[model samples]
Target: MVDPLLLQLAAAGAAIVGFGWLALAMDVHWEQAQGQRPQPAPVVRLLRVLGSLALAASLGLCLTADHASMAVLVWFMLLAAAVLTVAMTLSWRPQWLRCLWP
Candidate 1:
């Protein structure tokens, strides 16, 4: 049987991470439009990292507490991580991206 609590937690985590990404994107764009460098603030960076970790933990929780399959968990985690990566890429310059990515 599906554990309702696990499902609720997973959904909440996903929503939080998704909204975080959207906010990051909007902030970056707003800064760029105002003729400012679109660098991520320290708090934003911390939040991104924390959000990624939380999403990963949420996936693990779902896997353990519910009947979710391994494949589903893996894909969901990967997708969440990928969104963070893409946001980082778009919000920073090439040198910053290289330093972070490489």
Candidate 2:
């Protein structure tokens, strides 16, 4: 089995990167998908898929490190961390996370 600390850290990193990929997919920066820089649809699709896969991997890592009950707890904790990452990014970097529209 993998070390619990490693699993936990991996889970947290995966969650954050997953959220970042998702945010990029939606072009939350506005500058990424608009007139001066129109991102390709395939790239956006890939980002979305990667985001999901990363989140899934986080759960897999947690499950590998512990029993089912502990795995479930870790999974939910990672989920909460992921949500917090998104919220904090939106709150702290509103300029970087501007809507696609005006």
TM-score of each: 0.40, 0.77
Residue-level lDDT of model 2, residues 5-78, one tens digit each, is: 99888988887777766777775543442435676888788878988998888888888878989998988988
lDDT of 1 at 16: 49
Alpha-carbon deviation at 54 in model 2, angstroms: 0.1
**What are the runs in model 1 whose C-alpha is more than 4 Å off?**
1-3, 14-22, 29-40, 68-102
C-alpha lDDT values of all predictions: 0.52, 0.73
Model 1, span 1-102: residue lDDT tens: 667565656655564454344444355433543345554567456656655665666566556564667636654765666566556655664233322211
The true-versus-predicted C-alpha distance at residue 102 of model 2, in Å, is: 23
Q: Model 2 scores what on Cα lDDT? A: 0.73
**TM-score of candidate 1 on Cα atoms, chains taken together:** 0.40
**Model 1 error, position 25 (Å):** 7.0
Q: Model 2, which residues run further than 4 Å from truth?
A: 29-36, 94-102
| Residue 66 CA displacement from its true place in model 1, Å | 2.2
* Best-fitting candidate, scored by TM-score: 2
